[model samples]
Target: MSSKCIVYGYMFLNVKMSSLLKRALFNNSQSIRKTAALFCNATRNHWNYQYQPGPYPKTPEERAAAAKKYGMTVEEYTPYPEDMGYGDYPKLPDIGEDSKDPHYPYDNPELKRNFNEPLHATAEIFGGDRCDISIRRRFSLLHQWTWFLGTLGGFALLMVFLEDYKIGRPVTAKQIPGQGVHYLFSPN
Candidate 1:
């Protein structure tokens, strides 16, 4: 073979080997399966733990006593961090005077007229349009798993093409040792 063919052969082999190595590293199915199995086993073992509901306060009196002991009552509460006695932090000014807010709902004349309004009306104000429109939709874990598998398949196909390009289709037996072998030593 000429020097050109030799260099071409070397380059072809190098590309084939490099691509094959890359594909093997990225798409090693056996290693992927082992890792996946280990993760699944760990997760299963963790979740297999026994779950027991905590004991409830047997009676209303016990519940009240527990609540009182824990300082859950409004009277026992302290002001928030900002409201506590002065610290290095600057004090926040009241919005009543500085804000352009007309105190739309609170300043309404109907509020004074309805000092006798039901508790549900006050609850409506707090719960108004603040409803959480931000909902989370759950997706199947299989979707991600299948995506990973597809990515590996794509890489493997690319490697197959690279190998085919580098090493031409398999040589026939006649082209190898069949035709040339007998002529070499015939010495006719």
Candidate 2:
């Protein structure tokens, strides 16, 4: 080809062949799978779009619409991170009284305030919020220390147990440290 097209300022290809490479690869205007819209959909404020909330509610009507959409009163409604850009906010479904609904274990203000108690059975293994609670009873600083030190100590203990063998060693047991000579003051 004579010229190369750079789509969305990312694709800078030196095209020399004539194939589907001409119509498909250069721009998001034509292709079905690799579209330019997906790559160009960067949020104004956040890097990761899936993890962040919408950038709506710039006005009172927007807030009322959002509150109504979530089936909550305007006073009771809480927006996540409040106004960044237009996001398809997840609809808040009613989880009922027992808190067994599928939506209950997801991130929400109520779950943050309420889920202080340890999760059990299915709840412990299933949801991100449930496992993330990680109360002091189930997880602790001591646990973290034990996890780290246990691995190091266990490896060291294995090495200490194995280093005494004469299979591949050049020294005798009497020449080994602590076997015959004292470490504090040992004269050869």
The candidate that achieves the highest lDDT relative to the unseen native structure: 2
Q: In candidate 2, how many Å is residue 98 off?
A: 14
TM-score of each: 0.22, 0.31
* lDDT by residue (tens digit), candidate 1, 1-188: 89999999999999999998778768886875786798877566545221221233445664455334333443332222433432212222221221223354553343322342222212333332433222232655688788999999999999987885675687656444454445445557
What shift in Å separates residue 84 of candidate 1 from its native position after superposition?
A: 37
Off by over 4 Å in 1: 1-56, 68-139, 167-188
**Which candidate leads the pack in TM-score?**
2
In candidate 2, what are the lDDT values of residues 1-188, reduced to their tens digit? 33343352334333433445666566554574545556776643466543344455768888787666645678876564434333424333333223444454545544332432322223434354434333325567788899999999999998999897757547645555555545565585
Clash number for every model? 0, 2
User: What range of 10 consecutive residues in model 1 has the weakest lDDT sum?
Assistant: 87-96
